[model samples]
Target: MVKYADDFKAMVVQEYLRGTIGYKVLAEKHGIKSKNQIVDWVNAYKKFGIEGLFRKRRHEVYSVQFKLDVLSFMKRTGASHAETALHFGLTNPSMIGDWKKKFLEGGAEALDYPKGRPVMSDKAKNVKKNQKPTQQDEMTCEQKLEQENELLRLEVEYLKKLRAFQMDPEGYLEKHKQRYHSNSKKNSD
Candidate 1:
């Protein structure tokens, strides 16, 4: 995504409103990639005034319920992403599209987690645990070697499949359809 300065956006919007030039010419003059960018800025300016032109510094986390509500409202009213976003006081309309795509692909549970790395918990910060060694720690050398060999075999199989997927994604997915479905069904059960 391209980040434009608020002043530059305001200037473009102002120039567009002046009515002497259209979006295409203004976009070409200002070296903007898309004419639709001007349209979005103008609409945002009209609906939200100057504050709409400003960039957001921090990400605002929305609840899963809120995302569902936005999607439901869009479906119920048959509103476009831009209209729904404006009604919800959301700065970005594309977020609605993204949510809809995710919901369709993975259902509502997919929206339960937010993007980016999770924060480290206090428990994770502690180096030592108040627990005794497991049975694996007391295993004989022969047993440990057998376990390590089994792990190596699994890793080799995993790498083979990974290479196949990277080489031919569509073919790999088609081949693994049964395995994927079975694993998902087992988890659900």
Candidate 2:
């Protein structure tokens, strides 16, 4: 959790790489929490220089092939998560662990970058670009009916819930606890 400066990290890594002192001894000398952290820094420095020692501005997106290659190399060499991450120039070793888990659970497809936003289809994009406001009636019969049905279902659910709350305000509140209730209240209860 401690954030070490880039210069400090480089210095530590250089010291470790010099072969003058062991990780445990260096960690003890520098008052570091774990010797493994020093090992990670040293490996990162060796593979990626000082850049890997600093925190990245944004998350790195890896291709499926790249992920597969990293996993393959790790397996072939019997390397640990930290070692593999260091070799790959990844700042966090946990990322390699996550990739391995995803690969094991769902194969290469699991390594694909998750789409963060919904993209408009080509037709929709053209419509928007042309500044043509399409009417709801222009939708296919099936699509119009589906949208109406969904709206009706939502309204009915809302009314039923509202009626229940009106009929039994105390009981409704008692049944549904506030998710963000104060910790002091929880402790007292």
Candidate 3:
């Protein structure tokens, strides 16, 4: 929405209040897109005088409690967003709508400021800084012993298999071919 100056809004609103011309004709004469904009301005002017028509110079920060209060007031009075904004001296009516949406979606917490990036814990940082690569650091004693035992078992199994293969390479080759052929036939079928 295009922001009109306070004086311009007041002038338009005053002209609108004169009751001679309709909102559509007044909007058309002033090059405003929607008649509702003029209506809103007029409503704001009535409710809040000249101050409601003025745009805020800086961004206004509303606390979570304030947002909740606004929502509660709107619900209690059955007021529209524009009416609620005018009552609260807020420049933008959409802000009340946004607050209502947030409140409905997540209750009160949604109106609070968003949680930013997560911070790393001090213990994690200290651990990372102090850690170094070393043989002992690679594995615990129990892990190292288990790994060595596994390697020895694997080596023994390999030697036994090698001896068996050497003793009967032709027999092993024949058995392997028969096994693979049957498996392949099963797969194809």
Candidate 4:
């Protein structure tokens, strides 16, 4: 699943190791964006040799515990993402960063979240297509009340904002321009 081929990585690593060129020059010559990328490739090459640069055919899934262990190891040892990945035999160091972000935002259970699209078997798809709504799918009294409360709260908030805008459209827009700009930037991206 590697992006760069092993041959290309080897060539870059060898060129860098030759001492005639630095990472920045090599990265620019090869159209790579970051010098850090070359640093990682060279580190991997030095640590694991040519085999480290080879592409993996199959995707590897790490268990939640294994992910937690990797994060903990990094935390304990103060290793960089690339170093931690090499220590753990992980090809992609960015995955460790993602795991750390998810863990920080949602704790260990977030590590258990599935990646990629959900695959439905033929039988399951057929069953889902033919299934009709059942009482079990219906909201309970408390859930119904909660939904109503949420709707009412949103309506009230919308009305208040509408009133403010109606009173002073220019002022309201000026007040909210930053929010609008941020939202537009997100949508554009």
Candidate 5:
């Protein structure tokens, strides 16, 4: 069924190239289920070029390759359920979960499709790798307080210096005052 869809998708794209008016008429003429299906093919062709219409089936799931492929498709493809269904020759996209289960239960070899259709990951893999830390990650109260205390200490040091400077130019410059006078007098000389 998936293989059939790939052929059909190629057919649709070919007919579309023959021209839009004739394409719609031929679709209506041929009793194609949904005119939108052809339209989707055309759009996909425009976006991905000819090869986008090809179907892919996994021979095995959970292979580093399979995980990488699935994850990549999920992350980068952003395709709709209809596309996924049409893609795997699946009647429904939910079967992807079946594939996942098979993958988990058996590994890559579990990725068997009905008939002899090969599993599709293209060149990419769909592995679920570790994710980068997010703000949601837990932090200990001690760690949190340590950070705050460090920040507060720095702030206090800054404020203390600011206050001393604000209080009197004399103390702030006591050492510099003599030096300042001497430098000015030396300059005049």
Candidate 6:
């Protein structure tokens, strides 16, 4: 799956809003792999309020209404799963699918509201205000950790390839050695 930044989505959304480019053209121009992405962004903005379109909220889980509206809009718009995924600022289409199924099964209320974090006492808040992360802060930290893990995994794979080549230094050197030997043989001949 192609992962895109929020700015890219916003840019495509803006271009779309201006009526300058069609979905196909915009997808081609902006490197948007999915045509539904363009449609999703515009439709998402139209479907839900601001939250539906933005990617800044990485910690707080969205309300059930938010998910319902997004899925409902995607269904209404005839956008693909990829577009709906992008619309929700989520990278996973399965999540969109799951929500849609829930909504379908349980009506609009299928998206269940999370049980909120426990309330901290005034003294605890005072201490938390001074130092330490809250549940929300921890959630964001976990998101960051996941993002970093993805980057590290890619980097590790790249490095493993490098190490594989490095481990057989003679394999790389063999090519040059063979070329040199061929040149010397020709010279001698």
> What are the per-model C-alpha RMSD values against the true structure?
14.3, 18.9, 29.6, 15.6, 25.5, 22.6
Pairs in steric clash, model 2: none
TM-score of 3: 0.52
In candidate 4, position 121 carries an lDDT of: 100
lDDT (CA) per prediction: 0.74, 0.69, 0.69, 0.75, 0.52, 0.60
Order the numbered candidates by TM-score, best leading.
4, 1, 3, 2, 6, 5
Superposed model 1: Cα runs more than 4 Å off:
121-189
Give the per-residue lDDT digits (tens) of candidate 1, residues 1-189.
Answer: 788899999999999999999999999999999998888889889977998777666777776656765675576558788777766667688888988898788666566668878777778656336556777669898998996676566445545665666677678767766755454234223
Q: Which lDDT value does model 5 have at 3?
A: 30
Which 10 consecutive positions of candidate 6 have the poorest summed lDDT?
A: 180-189
lDDT of 1 at 69: 58
lDDT of 4 by residue, 65-91 (tens): 567656755664578999887876666
Clashing pairs in 3: none
Deviation (Å) of 66 in candidate 2 = 1.1
Off by over 4 Å in 6: 49-51, 61-94, 98-189
The candidate that achieves the highest lDDT relative to the unseen native structure: 4
What lDDT is obtained when candidate 5 is compared to the true structure? 0.52
Between candidates 3 and 5, name the one with more favorable TM-score. Answer: 3
C-alpha lDDT of residue 51 in model 5: 60
- TM-score between candidate 5 and the true structure: 0.32
For model 3, what is the error of residue 104's alpha carbon versus the real structure, in angstroms, after optimal superposition? 3.1
Give stretches of model 2 more than 4 Å off: 1-8, 14-21, 115-189
Error of 5 at 77 (Å): 12
lDDT of 2 by residue, 29-68 (tens): 9999999889888777776678878877664566554566
TM per model?
A: 0.59, 0.51, 0.52, 0.61, 0.32, 0.37
* Candidate 3 residue lDDT tens string, 1-189: 587788988999989888899999999999999998998998877766787688767555665545654565466457788777665656688878888787678655566654455568999789879888678667988998996676566445545544655677566545555543453234223
Q: After superposing candidate 5 on the true structure, give the runs of residues whose Cα lies further than 4 Å from its correct spot.
A: 1-8, 22-26, 57-79, 82-189
